[model samples]
Target: MIGSLFSRRRPPPMTLPDPAIVVPGITATYLRDDYPLPPEVIWRVLPFQKHFGSACLHPDDLRYEAREPALIRPGPLYEVAYKELIDELRYDLSPSPEAEVPVYPFAYDWRKPLDMIEADLDAFIDEVIERTVLTRHYYKDGYDCRRTVTLIGHSMGGLIIAGFLQATGGLRTRRRRTCPDHRVSKVISLASPFRGSFEAVVKMTTGTADLGLGASSSREREAARLTPALYHLLPSFDEGLEVPAPLPRTLFDPQVWQPSILRSIETFVARTSPITRTVRKRTEALFAGLLDQARTHRERLDAFRLDQAGLGPRDWLAVVGCGADTRTRLTIAALEDGPSFVLTSDDRRNTWPNGTDTGDGTVPFLGAEPSFLDRANLVCVTPDDYGYWELEDKALTRFGGGFHGILPNMNMLHRLIVRFVTGAPDPHQKTWGRPAPGVRPDAWDPPIPGLRNKAL
Candidate 1:
């Protein structure tokens, strides 16, 4: 007690980073059948992740909400995809012992439609805001608790984020600010297929895709046809179809889909159903629903304008990957059996203006463009971008170019995300791969005079 007599030079106030929510990609979230007595883990059972094979997301199952326990529910996120990113944020973002920075990994059923997922996200945002408000540091520091959350979405999760914004009147609305409108401080999307991807078509038609991760089988292919989220990821941008002229670019039309898709559905129905009506009728209806719903979803996003949506350079950060051979174009022709697709070969070099490469290997340059983000605005990163300190990440990576699945684990991006959310500049002032357009909104604590470029 006697040692406390001498006054120490005042210790600085503890700085806490803004709260963030991470929305994972399609296959990133594990699914479980809770209706079962002990709850059977389906999508991820150690070596047995059959995707939708074990748990088909048919419309029939969705209609069975009256069942006792519940239907298939989302479980923990796959460690391979997000464990490193989440752990880094949790530890690094927490500045002091008193700091209780919230970094939530939101898990949702990927099988549901995009709009339904958006509604679920709307509620999740409210929960996050409330959780942040209850934190002791928030009240002690006098930070705005309500509208101070940052959203980081990866892969298909990015599509969900954009959909949530549009649905909640956040991005596009000038009138009444809804849940996400005020709650979300900024949005950062990593390798999101805003214009959709050709890979989705490959999965639906052939039940297999070269997504840089995950394995595929016939069961998985049948599951892909049943899975609704894959359909939503179908390519929407113009010129995605390089060859097969006279074939309309619309993937939503059942006529354009490979005949094998119909056969697959028929096979699934014959095995699963009780043969009530003919298998053809049931198969056709299911196919129509998946395509039609995806069409409406894509149309809504294509029409959205980010400039008019009250979001600026700082509010929305678009992170895309490059320097990899990707399939920016496809050759879907009417063959002997029926219409089928021939994907771009790995050796072929695409003509994306960004670099010698096409995309992140999964999302092409055209696929990454959302009609709102210009060429200069996209924050492009490459496989060679992993910092010197991140030797482990580099060594572990077998295929350096097609970094579609592991973008979040990039240490360079972690620093950028921290700076953007905390409003605190990194010690070293530097720009990553491509410089995104516009200055950051929150630059300094007291607003530096010539700090025009600190916030990007």
Candidate 2:
């Protein structure tokens, strides 16, 4: 009886999942200026309430071997945007609270290009694999050299993950290099815009790209022009454009950009940089540079064959949120004064759409779904994709337009991520798991185990 009581006290534990690395979206990392003695916190959460114009990068910053504008560098991940998800993963992922589950947070300069972030991520994955190898494992002998790690990328971070995986996989393209860490067995992307999101266009148009930090000013608009990250996120999906462009029908063509877009750069350059040439010439050059780089990045991704020799589309779990009125489509009217965007309401309701359940406020479903995968493979969740008990969490996570930012905090997402990473059986999901455009209700899954809840 005493032995039985002792056994009851220490219940058998579940297996710890693969070590995970969480990469947050844009504006989610703290950027600090270390040029000064004290190193001022320029782009953090609360401090960012007061607009910091100095955080604006020069066009030179886009160069491969360029330093910060003024010794500015990226710091830790923003708390409100990530802490809840991180804490949940760290604790719930472990067999017990006392047991440590390696959930590394990869914080990068959100202002930089996606390619740069992907390269850094390649290195980070290697380090994480090494670190996890050292951690004591009951099943393994000396060290698990081939120990794989699951990557959970939120928003643009998922784009970075997709780029990284493509770089490592069979099909190679530009910005593609060798990634030593082949142990990345699974990837979980939350609200990732694979094709692109119209919200990025809104950010470029209006300086206020609200990623939790409500720092909007003339300077913010100027900063957005140079932010290669935003350009990379410019929408290229079929359903993205309501009113098409004049000729190219692509945002990559600078002719499609609003005249104000170029004028903003002119004003920004005249104020900040040494204009060797005329303001108009310099503005056009910088504008074209941003779009050119983004075009290259997009082409590389588009060329990335997910159904490669070794890499399958199902290896990634893409959890896109819907049922939120999103700016799923935009009308770009060509005029004498160049193309003017008619996004959201013509009244400038800040370009937030009132469309159907097409997207998660920021990312359109037509764009977020993998280029290869269709309705049968894609897993679409919603803001209300949570249990009754998780309503508190759902409440805390403001749903509507900000669904893209707060998606990672959803309990249903957390549960699905854990299940996918740990190889845990999906225990009869009872939440909002809808099929895509052509997918039948009965044909969602269960037929293919790997392609079931285990995809991005």
Candidate 3:
């Protein structure tokens, strides 16, 4: 009688539904592709001298040997967002058994070159094809050959996806592709710096930018200088974009750098200090190489002519963050001495041809958008509604307000993402190109919350 009274009730078993589409997610920078153990161990054993230890090791050598994680370790944002998506879709779509969405998270060393990242993504695509097409996973689940896989990318990951799409001819050439197995049906990008970021310029010049790394150590600063990927993040000045003219010249041509800064870099590069000189030489070489590469990469991207990439109306969607303070326009004046420099911004210059103010925290609202997307394919979300995701029938849905890092975890955003993946209609979503009603643009705030104090 006592045992019966204390008996616990068993919950119903979960019934997983057949996989309809395979969704793969790519993450942002500063994320550890492999577990942090080996590096952490090295850091622990190394002497903690200011700039004279293994801690000062650049990312290029360190990351190449780092092992890739079996699965992406979900962050706080991913945890909340993915959980909500799974719950909502399971209940809303009543398929045989519970709906099981096959989401494969791909990991890459964020410090590596873009071409290397693209190659990793390509390999991931091949792996997915092996699982779904070659193995009959799609056919077993009633998904026909016409069904295409979906890609979701955040931050720099979005750029990686774009490059992958271009290389694989997955954009407009999906239908014309000779290989049916590697087709991508749709792409969703969040806060991608397609045009570039002024923040990157700040980091390169000042050795400051909180790229999601925990603390700003001397080593972290040095690593930023050595990482080729950071240079790639600099502003791209193609036609139709209005950025500070001096900024691009400064980045591409070493001669344009302030004389003092250039001299300091040269001195550091030539230092005979046993510990720091090697690091400095590598950093200097990285700087020169990245400038040339940035120029070449920008030209290649411009040649792609994304606006004319031939994607269908529903093939692409870009979620833009707006109504927050973002660095849209920058003015750099060389100080009286060739070595000193001053940077300035005018909030009034927030629109195209003058400034860039509209954005989440890190990406300009305009920078988040691609030249090819008309009003229909863009969604603008503001800070007030930053975490909420409302679905719409049209291709774009904008949130009134939110920070860049917080977007992935918002419940509403998760729901909307689910709807897009499942091709659900949202009657309330706004028409393409039209801003949400009564949404006022907010004053300039730092892109990442709490970063104002840290990023100088």
* Top model number, lDDT: 1
- Ranking by TM-score, best first? 2, 1, 3
C-alpha TM-scores of all predictions: 0.82, 0.83, 0.66
Once fitted onto the true fold, the runs of candidate 2 whose alpha carbons sit more than 4 angstroms away are 1-16, 47-51, 63-69, 97-99, 138-143, 170-181, 209-216, 240-245, 307-309, 346-357, 387-401, 426-432, 446-456
Tens digit of per-residue lDDT, candidate 2, span 1-456: 532322233222326576789999888888877887887777766434333466677654454212343677778987766787888888878887555788999988888888888888888877776676556551242224234577898888888887877766622222212222355667788888888887788787876643434535676677777888889888887655755533577888888888887887777677666545677787787788889988888777777765542445567777766666666667888677677888555322212122333777677776687674555666776656655554454433542127677777677677667766666665475223455545666577521254333222
Cα lDDT over the full model 2: 0.67
Best by TM-score: 2
**lDDT, residue 118, candidate 1:** 85
* Residue-level lDDT tens digits of model 3 in 64-108: 332223222212223322344445544554343433455555655
Taking the tens digit of each residue's C-alpha lDDT, what string does model 1 give over 1-456? 211221122323435556889999887778888877898887762344553544675434432221234567889987666778888777767887578678899999887788888888888876776667556676455343223577899988999988877666453222222123355667888889988888887776566675423555676777778877788998887665753656666888887878887888787777666555777887888788889999898888876666444566657778877666677777777887878777647433544433433787778767886666655566667666776655366433532224787788888777666655666664565435443322123322211122233223
RMSD of each: 7.6, 7.8, 12.2
Model 2 clash count equals: 6
Better of 1 and 3 by TM-score: 1
* Candidate 3: regions farther than 4 A off: 1-99, 134-137, 142-147, 171-182, 213-215, 237-250, 259-285, 305-310, 336-341, 344-356, 387-402, 427-456
Report lDDT per candidate: 0.68, 0.67, 0.48
For model 2, what is the alpha-carbon lDDT of residue 300? 73
Clashes of 3: 28
Q: Judging by lDDT, tell me the better candidate of 1 and 3.
A: 1
